[model samples]
Every structure is written in structure tokens, then in C-alpha cells.
Target: MSSKSDAKQEREIKIVGFLCNWCSYGGADTAGVCRFRQPTDLRIIRIPCTGRIDPLMIVKSLIQGADGVLVSGCHPNDCHYAVGNFYARRRMEVLKRFLPYMGFQSDRFRYTWVSASEGQIWQQVVTDFSETIHRLGPNPGLHQTVDSAPAVSWF
Candidate 1:
């Protein structure tokens, strides 16, 4: 690839990954140790558990101009915290459904399961999600609404 194309690709794609510390994060680490090829566009945030992740955090990231968001945690019934991922799944599902309603594309957000031992899975997930985000392109962000009057009065 030419330098100009490489620079354009780097600048155009940004993916934020929220990974559960006990499972998904370990999976990513294992993938790295195993020398699995992974996408460079992802920025990982290691959270204690998927249950601790608020949907608003993902939304905030999108609002701030992330092209996509990926949330990965322990497999169902395999959570180290014993059910954290279950709650996370439900919350993520709701968020996924709600994003389109709020004017964001539903495809921009994704949630999945990956165990600590599933390094290959982690690599695949990152690759696939990164590709999907690339197809979706840059997020335009939320639209601003017109207000009748300014909140603060300078006069």
C-alpha cells in the first residue's frame, strides 16, 4: 500500500473495544502472545466486568466520533464474576436496538463473547468487527437541535 493510502486508512477508521478484564482482555493478550494478526485500528479499554459497563459509555464514545464500538466479555455461564456477562448481554442488546432510534447506525456497535482461552476467537472477532466498521465508514455524530433561546443571558 502507498503511504498516502495507509495514512488515509489510519485517519478514517477508529474502533473502540471494551473488553472484560478476566476473559476478553486475557483472550486479546493471548492472541498477541500467540502472534495472531489483529487489526491496528482498535483501542482497547479493559473494564473489570461487562456488567460494570454502562451503555452510555459506548454511546458517549460514538458521540465523540468513534467509527465503531466492540464489547466482548466471558461466554454465557462462564463469567468469572458469575453472571456479569449475562447482564452485559442484555444491556448491550438494548443499546444495540436503541442506537438506530437515536439516529446512529445499529451496525456500528457490536457485542460478543470470548473466553480467556479463546485467543483465535478474539483475533477473529477483532478482524471481523474492524472490517464491519470500515464498511460503515466514519460516524457523523449526533445532530444538534435548534434551541429557541440561549440558556445564559449576557445582557
Candidate 2:
């Protein structure tokens, strides 16, 4: 892609961020409290732990119109549950190896470790991730909007 085209496209990237409540989420909150100016294109979803992030959720986020997905959690051995981030790291490694060949690019999905005190890191991560996705152009997967019907009530 030409530099001119890339520059024009950078203004439209949409990102979905999945942050672990104990660490990354706190980091983001701190960023906010500190008045850090971060990109507004990302929609954040807080999960109890990064291990709770299902790979399908990544695919689903893309399908629902996010051009990129950022999964952030505690550093190795620093998870609130002690080992949850390790499991998350393993799952992300395996998924990273396969998701791109199926259409998603490395820029379309990313995983990172951010601790509660790393507010600047969290801001920078989101800023940089969004910029990369912007430069890569949009993902075709993001155009596939969800169409499933509501689940049956169990009352």
C-alpha cells in the first residue's frame, strides 16, 4: 500500500480491547485518572482474568466490526490467580500461530502484559496497536456483522 493511502486509512481503524480486571483494567483506569490522552477508537471489555478470554471471543469481536483486538493482562506470575496469565499466554501463542493464516493478520490481534502500575504502558500499547492496525488497513472479517438470534429464555 502506498504511504498516501495508508495515511488516509489511519483515521478509521476500530479496535476492541479485552483487559483483565486485576491489572490491565486498573492500568487503563489509572491512565484515565491521570488524564492521559489515548485513542478513542477502542472499546474496552473487562474480564475477570485473561484466561477467561476464549479465542472465539477474539474472532467474534472481529466479526462484530472491530478492525483489531487487543488482549491485555497481568505480567507473568503476577496474575491475581497466580497462574492464569501463564495459561492465557499459552493459549495466545497457539492462536497467534493459526489465526492469521485463516485471514486475520498479526496486526489484527495482539496480546500484552500490563500491570496495575503500568498506566503509561497501557496507554502506549493501545496507541501503538491502533496505529499499526490503521496502517495495515481494515480487516475483511470486520465486515461480518453478527446475525444470530437471541437464545431461548430458561425461566
Candidate 3:
């Protein structure tokens, strides 16, 4: 694999990852420090907690041409904020099912939990998601049609 072609591939297929600050982010950092090999397609955005992330953010990323979206947070019973991960799990599950209706592939989005000490698991999660995204290819964003077009003007 040539560097030039690899760079081009990375540019063409972008993966956005939203990670929890206290857990998932730390897990990612640990992976890096441990020198675990992972795909470079994932662009990480650290948030305080998955519970605080808006579903629209994922939608916006997909509309903006991101090939995939991966959200990782603390485990169900391990959230620093008590029930934050619970809320996130429900929201992400519904969003996953709803993505196809919005013209985005359901597999383009995924969510999971990873703790700071779980670097190997984080590496595997990222690797698997990256592979899935590579198979999906680039996202064309939401399509507008006569029926799907908005009739109301906000302004």
C-alpha cells in the first residue's frame, strides 16, 4: 500500500467518532500510548458524556458527508454521571434504526461503551468500525426529492 493512495483513501472515506471524555476518550488515549495499530479514518470528537450528545449532531455529520459515525461512552453501570450511558444507549439505538429512513445506511452508525482500562477493546472496536465504514464507502448525504423536499420556509 502506497502512502499516496492510503492518504487519498482516508480523505475519501471519513469516520467521525464521538467519545465520552471520562471513559471512551481515555480508552482511545490508552490505545495510542500502548501503540495499538488502528485505522486512521476515525476523527474523534471528545464530549463530556454520551448522554449530552444530540442526535442531530450525528445527522449533521452524515449530511456533511461523513462515511460513518461511532459513539463510545462509559459502560452502562460505570457512567460517572450515574445514568448518562443509559440515556445514550436508548437514544443511539433509536437513531441507528432511524438512519435508514433518513437516507443514511443503518450500519454507518454504531455505539458502544469502553472504559479507560480497556485499550485493547477500544482498539478492536475502532478496527471493526473502520472496516465496516470502508465497506460502506463514502456517504452521499441526504437526498432531496419532490416528496421529501421541505415545503415550509423557516425564514
- Best model per lDDT: 1
**Tens-place lDDT digits, model 2, residues 30-147:** 9999999999878899999999999889878877767889999999989999899898898888888888776567668899999998889988998999888777677655434678
Candidate 1 per-residue C-alpha lDDT over 84-134 given as tens digits, one digit per residue, 9 for 90 to 100: 888888899999999888679989999999999999999999999998887
Q: In every candidate, how many clashes are there?
A: 0, 0, 0
**Error of model 1, residue 135, in angstroms:** 0.8
| Candidate with better lDDT, 2 vs 3 | 3
Per-candidate Cα lDDT values, in order, are 0.89, 0.86, 0.88
Better of 1 and 3 by lDDT: 1
Worst 10 residues of 2 by lDDT: 136-145
Model 2: which residue pairs collide? Answer: none
How well is each residue in 1-155 modelled by candidate 3, as lDDT tens digits?
A: 46544554655678999999999999999999999999998999999999998999998888888889999999999998999999988888889999887567889889999999999999999999998877766675656655665576789
Candidate number achieving the greatest TM-score relative to the actual structure: 1
Displacement of residue 116 (Cα, Å) in model 3 is 0.4
Q: What is the lDDT of residue 20 in candidate 3?
A: 97
| Per-model TM-score versus the true fold | 0.85, 0.82, 0.84
In angstroms, give how far residue 19 of model 1 lies from its true place.
0.4
Q: Which stretches of candidate 3 lie over 4 Å from their true place?
A: 1-10, 144-155
Q: Which ten residues in a row have the lowest lDDT in candidate 1?
A: 1-10
